[model samples]
Target: MLQGVAVWAQTDPGPQRIARFEAVEGSIQFQSAADNQTRLADPRWPLAAGDRVWAAAGSRGELNAGGAIVRVGDGADITFTALDERNAQIRLTAGTLGVVLRDIPPGDRFEIDTPNLAVVLDRPGRWRLDVDPQRNTTRVTAEQGSGTLYGEGGQPLAFNAPQSREYAFRSLAGSQPLALNSGDAFDRWSNERDRALAQSPSLRYASADIPGVAQLDAYGDWGNDPRYGAIWYPRSVAADWAPYRNGHWEFIPPWGWTWVDDAPWGFAPFHYGRWEQAGNRWGWIPGPPQRRQPYAPALPFGGARPNIPQGVPPGFRPPMQHPMAPQRIGAPIEPLADQVRRDQWERTQRAQQDQHQADMQRQQQMREAQQRFQPSYGQRQLDEQRRQIEQQQQQQMFQQRHQQEQLMRQDQQQQMQRMAEQQARQRQIQQDQMQRQPMQPAMQPQMPQRMQPQAQPQVQPQAAPQAPMMRQGGVQNRGGGEPGGRGSHGGPPPNH
Candidate 1:
């Protein structure tokens, strides 16, 4: 059945069971005003009440309440509001959300809102959406089947096919379909880190393992968790890293730590300044970790005054020939100050330039989007429609030629009659041509005088003996009348 585009709204109000929420795989650690739960959210996590969930990349948290499973890529945040069983709303504040439907009961609806756009899923199928808050753009890919997109004004944008993607500008009212790629999925996953922390606010934490430190005595017990695989410092440590008191630690699964290991953020740079993990234990490899102090003493300047030469006068100096000259202290002061000022100025300029570049890039993207998304009455779509039409025409032409050949073969009686008539006509033409040629002189002229007188004219050859015309019904004689054989019917005689 063809899918149509239409917009509809939820008629109910207040928090209700619009759909069921579950964590099919990975873990969905939730921390809200009323509840705090962190467990293996496999199979499904039913949302008894409104709660915000953080999903790990490549991991999925299904919100059956909206009939959609928002697959959190690398770092993503998704909030669900079950206004009622009849209608619910989902906001993919950041990252990517993959929504698939098992079976959508009638009157049940799912709506997803992003910073750039919103999608209302009233029909079934698999679809993925990516939200970029930095650039304020939303990208959606219809993986299988299709879905409908509801813009700000509540107009439906229909997308179909196995892997089709579309881009929606945040400030605009419509979207432009884009060529889809798998990498878009990963980009959505990677971009969710900051936004996830903002909504749930618990995912962000500080690292306690600084280099050259024996133990986190000041910030006690800072190490990797054997279960969740991320480095975590207790709230009791420094108050600086603590964002919330008594909140669930939702792990932001980084691409480190082997399948069964329990050390989040991997065993790389996130932990100690210089260390490598070998086997089950972490190893320390040191060099530059200890050398970057702010101040150090040069050898000759060590705490002693130099001895003066015996002849030197009390108020005289060694003509400034000393390795550590007195006047050198203030020399080039202006040049040094100038260098520092230049560095500061350059840094400021660079920052301003960078901001300008970013703005230009954004504007260029918006311009390109506007050009591509101009209101179309679906006229440019005719190229694909035309291709389909031409294909059909070619198929029809081939079928017609095939049918004509079949009909000719089926009429065997007419074929035989046509062949016989053609052959008879050919024979008559040949007979006429033969009759047009005069009979060749039977006797050649004999030499006269010198040789015996020409022999008496050879008996005039009787008109070359007429050949019998063989017909199916009767045999008839055909007398030759021309140099070439001719039939008595005034036509060429048959060769036979």
Candidate 2:
């Protein structure tokens, strides 16, 4: 993962890296840092410190912490104790987890705390940890890298690749290290997922270090522009689809209002890149590659506002504008703030117009009532209007119900027609089989009587009757047989 020193202006605590739910399956539940109530997990929501995730039975969850991938298996529980550019700490309470570390920068820490021991990953590799609460044991298996295990007493036990050990809760006193056992179904699943991520074609255009970039390959196409370089265009979007429109806003701490997109490939493009409108299609520009790209909560229209970090050297200009200013091509780009103001003004005007019309109607009704000196007349008019409205509503409801019934009848007719056709085809197949059965015996060659022994005298008697049957069978076969025949042999049984 790329490590950056730039901090978001809205976030006060420093430059905090945000992790996201890359993949979610079945009943995955999560609790945010600021809330205790658990909710069904959404892949669009970012993961941060103090957040808890639970993969219920028959469920699986995957998280991308920077470049490292953490997969949670069924019945697993985990919490993000700390997550930022410099450190990623996870706490596992029960079940299984698989971690694939792509890179670990210097001075940065990646640790997993189990019930019994703290497993620190010091190198880039794959590791699996399983916790059995009933046994009060935590098993750590280093599939490819080395790490140190710390017990409750702070005793350190160094383990290298291809090693596994089960330690008692809070103690490593007499634990024996063993060879790593063969992985089970969870391990195979994790390996397949890792391979897919590694082979993503979007990685060539977007950085692999950016979480959720792998998901783009299936949902979009990557293209290049002379001006903006590589760009990604999403497939099967609405004609009016725009960035930040299909998603909702949530006030997440540190980042303030954040965008949670409904698309599976929405995270990386919305948070790390800028959008450009070309003709009627929108393309995402991931900007130039940086060793450590900064994370943005939302990239609003007309390019993202500069998120100037604190403690910068002199003369530092943030990359706020896209490669081409006025991000839209072939059209004028409107600033988001100005657009919001215009929409608000239009709404206010509409409201005022509606209110003025209502007042005019009220005054007209009052004047008629006063002129006639019959206040009950106004009430009668109101009642008549209400009755008209009720009649119209009832008419519309009747029309809708009639339409639904027509549709149901049409569907039933089509289904009956299909069944009739299918049955006809089945009968044709059975008739064809019956027609072919009698021809098989007649097609066989008739041997001379001298070729049979004298003990087969019954065959001769049966042969006389078969001769007539063969002639009848041949006549039938001739009707369906080929045009030409071998010496009147009934066209070789119709070349079946």
Candidate 3:
């Protein structure tokens, strides 16, 4: 009992962190980090240290913080002892929880303490913890990777896919191993879920390193916009769907209003980038994933908050059912800083905002310069177009001249034939008149005038006609139109 107090005293809480509520189902209630009151659980609820979540009968809950996913089964209670970037500590008082640590950096910690012993996962793996305080026993089954069960005397029993008994910490001098767990329906379900997420086409376009991208793939499909690069649209949402809707506003200590979304895949999109209206729908612009994310949505706009169930009432505190039980059942239980201080999240946030504003200014300047350059571009296009029209007119003139010359030649030929026919007829008539009657007035006969025609000039059409390139926005070049690509994710919330 004195040990708890000593550990709590020596510990220095550095900063606050957020764990993701990946999924929530059935009857479950969790205490909020912002308001310290037990409220109903939602998929996108952000949990932190000092929070506790209880799962009622036939209930299930899942918390995903970075690479670790801790799932609570029915009739279970878990407390967050230390939930931060470097360590993730939880105490399972009763019931069972399935844990899957996808990745854990070296020197990082993930521990699940039970009444009998403390289970520490030193590597990436899947494990299950079941505690029975009535029997004063705990059992840890390592399904994959490696872990260790530390006794009260500081003895470590290595686990490489083994099932082990949870003995009383100081009493058990030796530890034994058992068979590797074959997994259950939940394990199969997880495998299928991951496989589906891996195959998501959005994964290819987006940075796989982004934590909440898999959720995006599940909720939306990838599409490309001519103005923006690759984007994604939610499958089922209001036509005027906007981010920060269907959520509540809770005041994060030292930080202003923080939005908690109810959707399962809400964290990354809200914390990292900006939102652009891509026609009828909205798309999140994650920017370059190779940078730090902010605390609030990178870009905040004023919008109405969604109507949601109110948090736990004021002055509401859970009953203390078991006073002797530890929040975490582990050796040398480390304490978390309960005091609120300057938040590091908001610090990064301000820096990111400054950078974002600078970038916007630069972009505006570029756009202004482009606009100034457009007049000359349009002038050049107009000159080239006029030249094309003049050439076409010249070609038409030459073709018309040639056609007229050809028609004149044909008319002259027809006239000459008619003249010859008339002359022949006249000669024949004169002979007939002389034969029929006495010859008279021979002096009057004179030579007929010779027919003549005028000459004309011929012309040829222009051989080649060229057209210049006509661009709408001057020399601006854009991404090539491609059909398939994984969409990018992340962005700030819309107006409240």
Candidate 4:
């Protein structure tokens, strides 16, 4: 392990914590402490003290310093005045910034200095600071945190959540109460980003103390290893891909020859862990969670040398010899120049052959894994197709049932209508028959018959008296009254 350790000539104590550009939107640039020239910012680029970041108009940038998340709005300029184990200081020159101090280490200090005041974070919470150079004012909004603002020759003004205050740059005699306005697009974007990072799945595997761990959830997956405990493997990498291959090196002062990866999820793994080959895939082992790991400039392996840029600053003195140089036993006979050249050529050939073999092996392993997964993938596709067919069949059956029910209802309605019409037609027929029938004459009541004359035998011989009889059918009847007998006029007699 000692032989593999990289040696560096340090001018100052190494920073236990460093900030990296976690995200960038639109035009953003930075000036490094070692190189004063401004360059386009890369998300993987590590930030140190004396470095300045600028977000041009219509641009934004975000930085992750340990667990603290810092976001700069459009047209903002900020400088990392100090960043180390126990202190993080930022100088805001213009525009707005949103800082979320999720967890401040014990005895650690986080401060933001503006033209008007120096805002020192006192607790872990959300904070927003705005520097208006035109108005010569600094505004502090403690959206969900507490901090103290120190001004020139004035009392330290302490502000807490749900508070906003504005102070003049020249004097801090008093601060005017300002309304908390988080409705702006910048604040909304910052808050949304913070919420997403807070819920990253990578948090469960890696320690939050590691900067850029939040990005791992998007570009990689975490797995449990029996030997390495928790390890992370990057997704969508080529079979021949290896750590520190897709990045360039820049001599960042204090820590020379830093690696800047092109990958988005490249910071924390390269800076804080050891890479191991488990099977054919490379995984990052974040060491033991119990231990505090210092930031490393690069974790190169396989006798890799730093690609130092030209025109290095005079202050940075590279090592006199390669750190990996072997020890010599006494003073051996020096080799001829031709012999040295021949030995160098042989070593280069061996290294190239070794690299080629490793790449071929990795490719073979990937092909095998793909072969093993193909059947399962095909099975999943068949299962999905079956499910879709079943769903379609069920849906068609339901539609058919619905249509049948509707037709049955229509049939029942038609049957009922027919029955009603038939009944109505029968009623009409009965009414017409009743109107066609003939009428009969009313009957008159019969009168009682007169009593028959009591046997008048002797007096009838003297004279035949005329007796009036009822007229029947326009004929008069003259005869002796008899009971229930026919009259002389041939009409039926009435009842006696």
> For residues 1-496, could you state the per-residue lDDT of candidate 1 as single tens digits?
1111111111121222322332245555553323454544422223433566676666554443333334555456777664444565777877777765534567877677887667776567666777777777787776556556666666666656565544555434445557765765454543352244234311122221111122222233334444223332423423322111112222222111101112222221222222223233332221122221110000011012222223433333221111322322212111122334655887799999999999999999999999988756676577768889999999999999999998888798788999999789769956864665454455744323222232111111244554434333222333443222222233323232
lDDT, candidate 4, 1-496, per-residue tens: 1112233345343455678787788898999886687889876667788889989898888888776888999789999999877899999999998898977767989999998889899899988888899999998898887888788875587777988888897566667888898588897788788788769888777776677888888798899877557888899999867665676656666666666677877788877765656667777777665444568775423222323444544665432222322332111111123224555887899999999999999999999998877767688899999999999999999999999999999999999999998678658755753453233235634543333442111111113343433333322333444322243322243322
lDDT of 3 by residue, 243-348 (tens): 6556655444433344556676666666544445666566665544333232342232112321233562344321111221232222111112321122345567
Each model's C-alpha lDDT? 0.43, 0.69, 0.59, 0.71
The TM-score measured for candidate 3 stands at: 0.50
lDDT of 2 by residue, 330-388 (tens): 12222233334556887799999999999999999999988888558789899999999
lDDT top scorer: 4
- In candidate 4 the C-alpha lDDT for residue 346 amounts to 73
Residue-pair clashes per prediction, in order, are 34, 0, 8, 0
Q: Which stretches of candidate 1 lie over 4 Å from their true place?
A: 1-28, 33-45, 56-68, 166-168, 171-176, 181-496
Residue-level lDDT for 335 in candidate 2 = 27
Per-candidate TM-scores read 0.30, 0.57, 0.50, 0.57
